[model samples]
Target: MIGLLATVPALIAGIRALRDRVLEVAASGATVVAGVGLLAVVLLVIVPSFEILPKSARDAERYEQQQRLDELDDIDAGFGPGSAEEAGQEMQEYVDDALQLLEVAPRTMRTTTWSKSGTTAAGNTCRAFHERIRLGDQVDRSSSAERLRTAWKAESDHTSFFERNGVLELSVHPAAATISWIRADNQLIVESDCIPYAAP
Candidate 1:
């Protein structure tokens, strides 16, 4: 459209130059109008198609991620309250299964504990088991982060998980699981806990 519009002055100049030759003037004017009209029609069709393409691609990718997360959720739903060692084992298995499903390897996988002084959803002083997985150099950080965000959003529509200050959090029910993710440079760090404190 901009290109077509830019040619208007040139078209007017050509028309002015051929004003004495009525036939030529009419032909030139008609040609200019027809060209611009064609371009407008093409832009109308092409521009909207390009606009919708990226959104459709993102939606399809999100659907695939959601399906994978649903499978993971099915596995997670079976877990019951247990000792720290048992919860750690279950969280490890969850991470392993997720890695397998995602076809990505972690640079480092370790266990840690998150402690809080306040009472939790479980009616106890805060103590949670965490399994941290760090993506290796082999992974594409941006793409992985997008996929993880999509999966987390699909699992639960909670808006807090999408906040962009720094950390992203995911909480699962029944099992009291919580997952926190932070992206650093070219790596994505994921912390998962089967035994999580209540939201505070």
Candidate 2:
């Protein structure tokens, strides 16, 4: 009977050990199953969903708002920390460009491209080419040198002109130097052709 009692305690210890071993095996299998489930969700669901889901512009709207700021460089042509005096250069270059736009260079003058010499030469050639413009069917050659001097300043000052139409048209500014003109039926002729006609 004492031997039987000792055997019972040993049997109880073995049964407890077996129970612990079974529980450990079950926990390990469950961990593997959960790991597989998580991996399958990532590969099948999460990865495939990338194609269906819409993405962001990464705050592109915010970037566009920043672009409109005055601190940003060259927001547009009107962007300014500019001075009123700089507009004089703008006005100057405007007429220079007009020469090309109107196809009127006749020849670059004895001086710079848009200098007094160039404008005077341009005025002379324009007068020679279109001097036949009729005022009451009367030819007006009031004086040659006076017309030349007047034409010279007209190009600079933006004043009354008829025979100097092409060069004058080019000189007249849209805003700062606006001048009214009486457009003739035949004027604004291309000055390239006028070069040969201009006096030597």
Q: How well does each candidate superpose onto the true structure, as a TM-score? A: 0.39, 0.20
What C-alpha lDDT does candidate 2 achieve relative to the native structure?
0.35
Q: Rate the local accuracy (lDDT) of all candidates.
A: 0.53, 0.35
Instruction: Write candidate 1's Cα lDDT for 1-200 as tens digits.
Output: 56556555556655665675657856687658756765675677557878798899999888866665554454456554443345455445445544664567444433344432343333333344555565556666566666667766776442235436555566544344555556664332333333322234
**Weakest 10 consecutive residues, lDDT, candidate 1?**
188-197
What number of backbone clashes does candidate 1 have, counting pairs of residues 3 or more apart or in separate chains? 0
Best by TM-score: 1
